[model samples]
Target: MISLLKASPAGDAVSALLDCHDRIRSFTALALRLARAHDLAEPEARDAAAAVHRYFSAALPLHARDEEESILPRLRGREPALDAALAVMVREHREHEAAVGRLLAACAAVSARPAELARVAPELEAAALDLERHFDEHLAAEERVLFPALRALLRPEDHQAVLAELRARRT
Candidate 1:
């Protein structure tokens, strides 16, 4: 599926975050596809499960931290109106984290034994759909409200600091 938003230039923290969002959407789609693919071969099942597992297990938490630790903290108090939105963002992150844990467990089961895919298909589908629904709202909120705020309220120096923090977390 095409990304909801256009790609931004490299080296911008917000752009990096947007890229991560695209990835989250892509893997979520893959999870849903894998769950529904009843006739998939063993090798394909294992590969798909591993790909989904790796992205959610590792990359997702880092993206969340990028928002929660690096971005949200700076945006706080800049606008009294944004405080409520920021709180919602944090709450949703927690919710997504919990949901991802369940999804990852399902992915792990399929990865360990491809035959297990049939047993776990319902769970995997439910979790993937749940995540898709939640991310649709959460990512929209950030793109609509938070990202514009980040660009408007923060100084160039602040953007550099945030970018540095994001890069440091990866390394």
Candidate 2:
């Protein structure tokens, strides 16, 4: 398991962000599966919703805050031209927060009546897909530009400090 995580490009400071993406995908898939298989009133539906809510609640704020406050700022400090891209990222983060809020509210309303998932599922799916797209583009940009900038601007200690701070906040 450790080997596999290490083998991935997403290891290290980028780890938290990608892990959040994986969490989103995993929970969203399970939620959709449960919704399609059983009525929303079923325990499976609630389980799925609860699991999704829990993971998103925990990871979203941390991931966004880290990117907005620490990682992106570091990049901007290195390359001022990246200011535009960073601003776009921050705006997208806000949009993502709003989208997740809508999902949380929708899940709350539909949790007791899994039957309503037929109506709610599409919106949920769209939200998940939209987020995935955002992650894809954002991660690609960071990989190509920001991550390298981070490595260039900071020494080994400072680079590791960024990851350490992120992990500490998780606790």
Candidate 3:
């Protein structure tokens, strides 16, 4: 599946986005598991926290930018009805980032006080759960409504531009 996504052409950038969503799901699960762990000081726990921290701090923001800067505007230009949903999705992105920020802080605190794992676990778990719910709605909206609309409405050049922007961010 990943190989196919990498082979996707410019017009199939939606495939790439979907692949990103899959990665987000996997990473979120890992983060959730780490959050629920009873021992924060375990070597495995710290490793998981570091991995989640790196992913949320770096790759997640880039994924959001791909939507905000590249995909959403193009979709908005063509689909008026999408205005409301897009606005909500945009706000949700910020909420996701903010929640990640809080989770990161909590992870830091738990790392320093391994015995306080019980204290911070709920907050981290809640953040992960919220993110999962948000993704369920947001991804459905994009897959069912936004992506199809964009595919139908966007010009070839528009797709080319989106692909370039998405590629640029990773580089």
Candidate 4:
């Protein structure tokens, strides 16, 4: 089991983003598991729901901003192919935000009343599945295409700027 609370390395913005992706996947999976676990005890259910909620509600938006504000803008117009990939990344970010809202709502419901998991399970499952599907593809694209392109195209100064922005946002 990946420790959801593990900190990503500092200084390397790209590696931090990759670590964030891993956390995203882990939390999404936890949401799915909690949704399906009809017999889970209330305390365990509540803890799991809260964990998922905290990650999506707080960390995710910051990660998106790191890409949109610091990383993507720097990479734009460097290559036509990269430009197209960046567009797709933006579109997918919007989609993920919408899906995350739905998932968070379900998580909030469960967190408020862990005993209500049975009632909220359907919505939670649907939202988690939607996000999982979208994110699986989205993370792949960034890891395979965008990150490599970012490494190739961005200047050392650009990376420093990104690192600063990433750190500043967290602080």
The estimated TM-scores of all candidates read 0.91, 0.73, 0.81, 0.91
- Per-residue CA lDDT of model 2 for 30-62, tens digit only, reads 655644553445566766766666666776677
Per-residue lDDT of candidate 1, residues 118-169 (tens digit): 9999999999999999999999999999888888887877877887777677
Clashing pairs in 3: none
Q: Report the error of model 2 at residue 55, Å.
A: 2.1
lDDT of 3 at 10: 49
> Candidate 1 overall Cα lDDT vs. reference?
0.86
**Which lDDT values do the candidates have, in the order given?**
0.86, 0.63, 0.74, 0.85
Give stretches of model 1 more than 4 Å off: 1-10
Please write out the lDDT profile of model 3 over residues 76-142, one tens digit for every residue.
7555678777788788887777677877776676556655667778888988888777778877877
Question: What is the overall TM-score of model 3 with all chains considered together?
Answer: 0.81
> In candidate 4, what are the lDDT values of residues 22-86, reduced to their tens digit?
88899999999999996999999999999999989988888888889888888888889888998
lDDT score, candidate 2? 0.63
Q: Candidate 2 at 41: error in angstroms?
A: 8.5
Query: In candidate 2, which residue pairs get closer than 3 Å at backbone N, Cα or C atoms, i.e. clash?
Result: 40-114, 41-114
Cα misplacement distance, residue 64 of candidate 4 (Å): 0.8
Stretch of 10 with least lDDT, candidate 4: 1-10
lDDT of 2 at 128: 61
- Tell me the lDDT of model 3 at 89: 74
